[model samples]
Target: MQRSEMPSINTQERLLAWALVLVCVALLFAQAPHGGDFYWSDSPRHALNGVFVMDLAKAMPFDDPAGYAYRYYAQYPALTILFYPPLFYAISAPFYAVLGVSHETALLVVALHYLALGLGCWRLARFWLPAAPSLAFAALVLWLPEVAFWGRQVMLEVPAFAFLVWSTVAVVAYLRGAPPRWLYLGAALLVLGMYTKISVAYMGVVYAALIAQRDGWAMLRNRHHWWVAALALVGLLPLAVLTLKFGQANLQSVTGVADAVASRTSWQGWVWYLQQIPSQAGWPLTALGLAGAVMAAWRRMPGLGFWWLGFGVGYLFFSSIDLKEARHSVFLLPSVTFFAVLLLHTLVPPRVGHGAVAALALLVLATAGLTVWTRPVFYVQGYARAAAEVARLAPRDSTVMFSGYRDGSFVFNMRALEGRRDLHVMRADKLLLGVAVRRELGVEQKGLTEGEIADALNANGVHYVVMQPGFWADLEAMQRFERVMSSDQFEEVARISTPANHKAHETELVIYRNKGAVTPRRRGIDIELKIINRRISAD
Candidate 1:
């Protein structure tokens, strides 16, 4: 505690902190070259949202979402629509301001935003741990295969996760009894997080509860802090209105999403989640997290305790839903990261703190290096190329269908080709996909037969069917078509030959000619005439 020792202590801490931060920055920048994975529906959708926002800012571009497709423009969740448009648009502003909205330039700008967000996570981690330890933790969370898997690729996660960490840091600082300014800052970050993604709203409550548990809930009754809470609510009002107004358009549709997610009560859902845990967190990390959760609860650390609860609920929701996806659980990543770091921090003895820090830093470096080595960034580029190819091969006004929502590949392709004037695209129904399978397999499924596919194709004016056969080949249509467009589902259909990797069979891409306008099979009178005609023909 002598003045002489104080300087050395300060110097050592400063040296360690800067060293870790530099490592974190290096890892993020290394992965920067391989931008987003656009093949997935959500990734490009988000990229385009940023693109469109900037496009409008340029000179009020008329390419509205409504004119694109029903679901394309349709209201679903307010997370990406209202919040990201403005958030990422602002992020993209400098790039667009300089680059002038060219597709390549715009995407490069978005990529920079990803880099900035990654660095922000690194900075936040430093506040919780010493610079070296924090950077190591940031690297682990940022470079996790799933983090790169979900993070850089777009979706509400990256921005949402960034704000989640920001708010958490604020709350922790406040709990550590920092100045009121820190609490206000936490409130502001929480507001932005909620605006970007609503699930984080629950996080604010959890954080507030943690604070109350620490300083006593009686403090919450004070008047001065009311403004902090008020400002948070005020910032979120625009998104709240958007959700309400959009949901009002079709009450059933809005409820259906939540209902659909809730309806998947199968035991298989649980099993699927259990199966995913090892791949996502890695067994070692998951075990560490569980230990961390138990230790926090045992010590009655409410911040960590409440976080554990939120993480558990979030993961359960992730597993049970019909829409089970890695992206849905993106909000939970911060909690997982926090607990993992907390466990390491708590379990390791202070005498060997330097060793623990070094070990963690090494682990992060190894994992991030592996992730970059194996990560899939080509998916997005593939999609962008496929969209361009589709614009070329098929005739003008050729109606194209992508069998599944393979990363909204078709949607982005269509969007990229806005001025074509000759092309239209629609998603093929699952039943039609089944029909393709039945035809190819020569297996009779009750509704999805060859006749159904013929009818559906005709009805939609589908002149060309563009698909990554390997991904959706199991569908009867892909089996029936026997035309391989892009060989791998993960690979782009354009400019690349399908790899030798065959499904049980190969589904080929076919351009079926539409001989005539498709007429709907009307009910009642039409059914009666069809029945009579069949009888007359038999007689």
Candidate 2:
């Protein structure tokens, strides 16, 4: 290459990098106007963990953080942070403290992951193709309806996916014998990915197998591998402790769900994800990815080969589990993207005119634009307003009980109070219903009786009641609770109406003020913790 050509090549690389930046930034702005309320049930729960971490940080209690954590859980039963890993919360705490916790803060944290993922996609794709082609592929990956689906909400998939992408990039660099730090970096990212979501642990197997296949088993004897393994063990220590204490619910959920799903499906169970690929990913890319996979394995493109291995193992592993979801197959997107880009890059010969290559790039960018611009988006409202009204009416440190499908939204909004951290938020679904993770809800045990519920509410010093008809219209719990709230013991203070849209179901919430309440008694938080524990561990 002539010296004159070098400037143009560098300029093209910089332009492509900036293009990827602009594309990812556009996605960040896409989620900004939701008023910090969530649609998905789990999204708010994930966001709450961040709030919990920041609250704990501010408290900086000299005594026992573990005790603080327990009392906090007793206060907010919607919190299942114990069931999942803590890495996301750790990442989110600084953002919460700095910007204040809201849906926006959570989405911003997810946006960082999205932007990092776009970077990883660019770096990984650029390894195999030219700058313009790489940029196109990364943009498409970000635009995949599936990626954007989880991307907008504060879920673990995009965050875990981000870690997987960067980890793969580092591992690929290490595979080419770039540097030792790349190896450790890959290991750290893999561990981080697992901590972000346990589903990514299979990726560790993907890494090991790729390395061993590349360098032979003698690579196992390398001291660097041993050192990284030791570091990984230390990194996983917190998970080990959490698993011992709170993992029963997760384990039961997986196995019990697997058993249930296995009974319902036939031969389609194995091929369910493959069938949905065309919809989740576009049909054109799906066909290209298949062809690309065949060509790459036939020609033996090493990095593409690594992703090929990933797609195979990820698909088989997730499919073999009795439960199935389209999101579970998200890891396959990289392999699909790799293959599709490789095919296009292969089609366009290197000697082709720059104008022709530029046209290909424009086509991909246009497709990405269509994906982002045309996709429909909706978010829930009313929770933030309801939370504000409750916070304003209830006294500080008073317990506010909520009963609804999206108690997570309610709890998350309540926790947003920077100074009113003392307010104890309770979920009626968790306390009155005692719905264990493994048991089918509304089928097993009946909820607390009205008299029992009244005594329990008064005994706990309940001052505010936020109830919605989250159950069947005739559900004894909903009916009995309504009867109790409507009685002279309580007065309807507010009727907050929430309109249904997307994941946010429509319902009328009646917030009641306890009129006959006295300076009632308070139960030990530990006793509440024990009751909560039974909901998790029992099948």
| Best of the candidates, TM-score | 2
Candidate 2 runs further than 4 Å off: 1-15, 258-266, 294-303, 348-378, 438-447, 525-539
Model 1 collision count:
14
Lowest summed lDDT over 10 consecutive residues: which window, candidate 1? 530-539
Candidate 1 lDDT over 353-463, as tens digits, reads 576675675566666666666663434234444556666766655566665435344464466554763565654433333221113223323344455566665565555
Candidate 2 has a TM-score of 0.88
Clashing residue pairs for model 2: 36-103
**Candidate 1 TM-score, true structure as reference:** 0.65
**Local lDDT at 519 for model 2:** 53
- Count clashing residue pairs per candidate: 14, 1
Scored by lDDT, model 2 comes in at 0.73
- Per-candidate Cα lDDT values, in order, are 0.52, 0.73
